[model samples]
Target: MSTINTLGPHTPRIALIGECMIELQQRADGSLQQSFGGDTLNAAVYLARELGEGGAVDYVTALGDDSFSDAMCQGWADENIGLGMVQRLPGRLPGLYCIQTDAAGERRFLYWRNEAAVRDCFTTPAAAPILAALPDYDILYFSGITLAVLGAQGREKLLATLIEARQRDARIVFDNNYRPRLWASVEDARVAYRSVLPYVDLALLTVDDEQALFGFADCAAVFAAYEQVGTPEVVLKRGAEACLIRCGGESFEVPAQQVERVVDTTAAGDSFSAAYLASRLKGGSPAEAAEAGHRLASRVIQVPGALIPK
Candidate 1:
């Protein structure tokens, strides 16, 4: 790959759109610790940590004016994540979820998010400015869970914004972190994914998620679908295995770092995505970015939470 794009901007401003919920983690001793997390939120924090002066990472979401939401914003601010695009609805509240992990570090989630404030993130009157401002960013990042939460109208608005952003040469990045329970039906999910895939410049995908979403036979099938959409850069993340990257008619396999003991795999892919994009924005080759992604994910899995200490 050339490592430079004519329309790409230096010191990029990245807006990551999604929800951040009140996350409760069940400890092995039956105790629980509360925190804030979501697929895109995790990526946003990691991106902020990785990019520093290289770029600015902002989170775009709506939350209640409650104290929990206030604490959440404070936490994000502490991480140096920009919250200028985040909205606080007077009567709304953020979603909630509980994470339970097995001995193998595999995680399962139980969600109580149906009435979260973010579901209307793009539908409120105040969202007009946010929507209008979206195209101004240098890079836009989102995930499948973002789509599921937005519903029909929000997705339509987001789609329109993405189209406009692409016309202005803003690079769009997508992560296929699919959660089936969040979607009403598989067909609906497929349609939403198809609508956005063509507009994405870089796609971060997991082999297992692709299989669950599209019933893809193998990695080749996943790559074929992405190739059809003309996504210029694609990274296929396989837990504990080499990640495959396709770019500029070439493919690279980057091996993941080996972790001696795994504590949690909650944000493995999200952390990887953030590091990969940060590396790319810093002018690293796709192969180098993939390695960077794997390196960060290795450490994240060794920790008990989505974010580790700086």
Candidate 2:
């Protein structure tokens, strides 16, 4: 079943909308490994890696005209992700964050993003043109974090954009990468999520986050809620367990590849979402896409950060 109608006979273009931050991964000896990462950005990178020439991918976000921002652009370019939709806001700066991991490689983050340029991504002067162009893409992908970063005005703009995009037959894909600290309150986050869920065609969800955010009693409840919203395809990822997928009125299960030692689970879910979307874009069935998702995410967690080396 096709999710998106391609703009034309050209390659399918998917735009991932979110932020990229300066990431500092803390080591045991007090050393820090620095890089650039964000939920949708991580998905952008991996999706690009997965699709190389199979499709086209673009990252839509706002960044400062700073050196770090320059480096981030350069890095994205190296991965062949499109920068045409990026906004370079003068006098603003990209946000920064540090990651700390427990012995089991579970990670926690400390953010310095209150003033990040991306907070006004859809509110900036350049945003009007970008928003105008966004609806033309074959697919529009974003995350819960994307919603959180965009303030009230930006969220309204984004909500309108999503509606317009879908009206043009662009498929909407959403990943539930919820971070409690990002929103003003649980209620605010819930409102933002509900505003967008009805437009989503495919939902990549984390079981626990759904439980926490919507108080979903269990996996069944989560699926019922998404089904009620009429999300045609839903993939539920329960870390280290078999992922469940319901698409085209059928259900499937894909077992994740086991890792002996989980190094860092930073981008596990993001990477999974990327590979799954890439697979679908490349004509794989929902079941095959889930397999691709598990394959990539298995490799991601064995690495030290959100992104593994190409």
Candidate 3:
């Protein structure tokens, strides 16, 4: 295996902040297989696995003090992810969801997360310490789902943390994983996203999500918007098609890896973002990083869940 030295002054720590939920998959025989998933958590695991001990990866989120939450923490620890920042709230529970797929392997999700513990992650007393320590990380990673769950006040706190972290020269990586059902309206999501754009150093966007959220006519508009936000690196992912990337004042299109069969598309973008960021943090060029993203995402989509077995 190839190893890349850590970047920046510190030990190169990455904090991925978001919620993880229990996932149930409805099988063909009417059975349900219990699992767990979240976009940021998925990226955290993949990033930790990709970085291997070259850098530290931490998953920052709130969970209930239940057995399921305990198992989630244990799993993250086993994967070499730091747990010191995970907040556990009393009398709360993690969210749950079910994945149903069609014969063609296209997937749809049904969520029961309105009252999930993570919604108050940044508001709880324990969140103070975590937010205070966040500025020390070398990189801060989060998704649109993270923003949505945080709501107004929590998002305000998180945005402040991002500002402070950016002032310390920490790189911010954002993935545009937009779920319309998660927000009150598209306008709300647009406002929330625009508010955080100034702090983003790298953005991993999906073409469809961008179009849906911001109403961009095409990829050019997406790139223009990111450029306006002053983000130095931008990668736009289009499922089964080529991904467009802009870095260091240049642009390139990297084709996706062809998969014979796609069992589940759960973590395709999350896995891709992980590999791409991992490669970039290791000093690979944008084109090389996009290829790495495609390779990992292709493998992930061939599997059945957000997390594939190692």
Report how far residue 296 has shifted in candidate 3, in Å.
0.8
Report the lDDT of model 2 for residue 114. Answer: 94
1-310 per-residue lDDT for model 3 (tens digits) = 0112235434579999999999998888989999899999999999999989777999999999999999999999989999999999988999999999887778899999999999999998889899999999889999999999999999999999999988887888899999999999999999999999988988999999999998999999999989888888889999999999887788889999999998999989999999998888887888888899999999998888899998
Q: Estimate, for each residue in 55-144, the C-alpha lDDT of model 1 and write its tens digit.
A: 888899999999999999999999888989999999899999999999999998999999999999999999999999999998899999
Clashes of each: 0, 0, 0
**By lDDT, is 1 or 3 better?**
1
Query: lDDT (CA) for every model shown?
Result: 0.92, 0.92, 0.91
CA lDDT for candidate 3: 0.91
- Which lDDT value does model 2 have at 176? 89
TM-score of each: 0.97, 0.97, 0.97
Error of 3 at 308 (Å): 0.5
- Tell me how candidate 1 scores on lDDT: 0.92
Q: Which of the predicted structures, 2 or 3, would earn the higher TM-score when compared with the native? A: 2
